[model samples]
Target: MTLPDPGKSYAQKRDALEHYFDRTAADAWRALTSDEKVSKIRATVRAGRDDMRAAILATLGDDLSGAQLLDAGCGTGALAVAAAERGAAVTAIDVSPTMIEIARERTAMAVPAGATAGPGEIAFSAGDMSAAPDGPFTHVVAMDSLIHYELPDIIEALSAWAPRVTGSIVFTIAPGTPMLMAMHAVGGLFPRGDRAPAIAPVPPARLLKAIAATPALKDFTPGRTLRVSRGFYKSQLMELVKR
Candidate 1:
């Protein structure tokens, strides 16, 4: 897997990622809107985010009360709203402007009036994780947003943000198992008018090794690995905590 070129400006990277999502915007909207049109696998993949978010909150336990939380690469604010409902002051960031817009709408509807997180306390913005508001958060949650990202890039981002988090970092990622790879290869054989955004899977062992090598995570310990089944494929939900 290739790392994003260090020489490229953050704007350039953001533009490229945006372009990709823009191309697949219709697919995303359809998946979100019409369940009848979505395949079983697609539905499972989408549901995995909600499951991951709940698991992250559960891991946070009583510590979630009044905790500062960062929901990086937040898509549509579901997880952020959930965190806020659990009493976290959350900052949710996404790369796509369209996504940010939808996230804001969702947050408004889902977050109850007089919630623990006051008005604007659970803010959603459009930008990469690097541009997410500075934080000394008690917990950080990134759901399945990294599926399209490479392992090296993921490790770098996690390492860079690790110092800002005091409690735990929990996320779910697509594992590069032979079965999963084969499924991708088979899916590629079919033709479509608009191609779906690429979902790159990472080898679980390699990802763990890379995370361990990162200086910022040297003292963090891996917690339980939950198996999230996506019909034909599977993902892993992992928790890393510093104590």
Candidate 2:
């Protein structure tokens, strides 16, 4: 993994990802077939998303009666849609236009009638996670999006945005582990089998140290960590709390 170009605007980097997914593979889950091997892989990926979504929701708890939520890097809008259903006014952002389109459709279908009259409205936009609409959000979530860059950039982005959130910032990463590293490498060898981008995991120790050193998180504390496995690999969900 490499740092984003220092001269490229955040939006520019985001656009590159958008174009990548759009031109490469837009719906990875749809590529799975009914073959026994494919079926298992599909199930695992689906379960992983479900598990991660649950973790994010659990971190937010049931206190979102009228909370403001930001779903940064909100691919497919699964979590954003769920949050809106649970009474959070959500602003979901993603780099891909294809993803934003699907997210808009999904959110429109999931949002309950009259829900928009309250604080649980849902909105979708195309932009970098770093460009998430300004908010003193009750909660912020970025799932499976940090693997695109190296550790330093991830930490800097997290630190810059931490102060804007009032509640916890929950994110998930493909942590660097021998098993997962191998999985990522092998997956790239079979791009047809994996529709998403092939991103390497970050070294967990280095990531943890950087998080600890972030100025914005100085007063905050790391929260729960969950191990979730799926599709021949495992991922870690970590939460950082300001209070």
Candidate 3:
């Protein structure tokens, strides 16, 4: 029998990862306790996924109470759960059904029984982030997922989604830093299994330009460049008001 093509099937990636999480969430949680290793991971391009979410939240500032949040490309519902924990009503969406399933399961596991109040409610679904349904969210977050699309595509996607946000849109992109370039070059030479889609790093300036060009968005601003390990993975935080 022919094996499945992993590259085209997001479901395959989701299934494999869900199984990994089911078998190892406890071990993964334990492994996260090593502060030295966590620090190293935070410094490199391959930063731990949760670290990216924390950084994004830090950038978002306080005053998130009762705000509507969207966790775009929410894998396993980490940021969604975090936002909900912060008392923001959250809707988490991913392209893979299996991923959404795992996210729901994880969210349920995190909530304590008989607790009257904790985090806000989290609704998980499978959908394309680039063309998500209309919801006037106070904040929209996309992390690590933009690397899969080219810069123009990323800009187009962001432009389409920007108007839906009433407050801010925060996202991280793999910067074209020297260390990251070198890593890319080495990876290109070795050719890993079936390469995942990753476009050239979208500079903060280019992202700004795209935001400016979009008709529905205003008040475009660039935020800090976050150093994720050896590579400088820049995250441009854009605040847009509907026009």
True-structure RMSD, every candidate: 4.7, 4.5, 6.6
Better of 1 and 2 by lDDT: 2
Poorest 10 consecutive residues by lDDT, candidate 3: 189-198
Q: How close is candidate 3 to the true structure, as a TM-score?
A: 0.67
lDDT of 3: 0.58
Give lDDT tens digits, candidate 3, residues 1-243: 122232434344444433433343324322432233533333343344546667787777555677888788776677777777677877777776656666666656333322222238777766677666677788788876665455666676677777788777777776564445445444331123322233346666776777777665555455445644433333333334343
Q: Which residue segments of model 2 deviate by more than 4 Å? A: 1-15, 29-38, 109-118, 185-195
Predict model 1's lDDT versus the native. Answer: 0.66
For lDDT, the strongest prediction is 2
How badly does each model clash, as a count of residue pairs?
0, 0, 5
Q: Which parts of model 1 are misplaced by more than 4 Å?
A: 1-14, 30-37, 109-120, 178-191
Writing each residue's lDDT as its tens digit, candidate 2 over 1-243 gives 222443444445556677665555565522431122544555677677788789889888866887888888887777887887788888777787777776666546434322332466777777778866668887888888876666666786787678789988888877755456556545542255543444557766677888887777786788888878877546778888886
Rank by lDDT, highest first. Answer: 2, 1, 3
Q: C-alpha displacement of 124 in model 3, angstroms?
A: 0.6
Candidate ordering by TM-score (highest first): 2, 1, 3
Candidate 1 lDDT tens digits, 1-243: 122443344455556667655445634653553344565556665565556666666777744566888888777777777677767788787787777666666545333322434423686667787556667887778777666566766777788678888888887778755456456445431234444334567877788888888888997888767767645446677788887
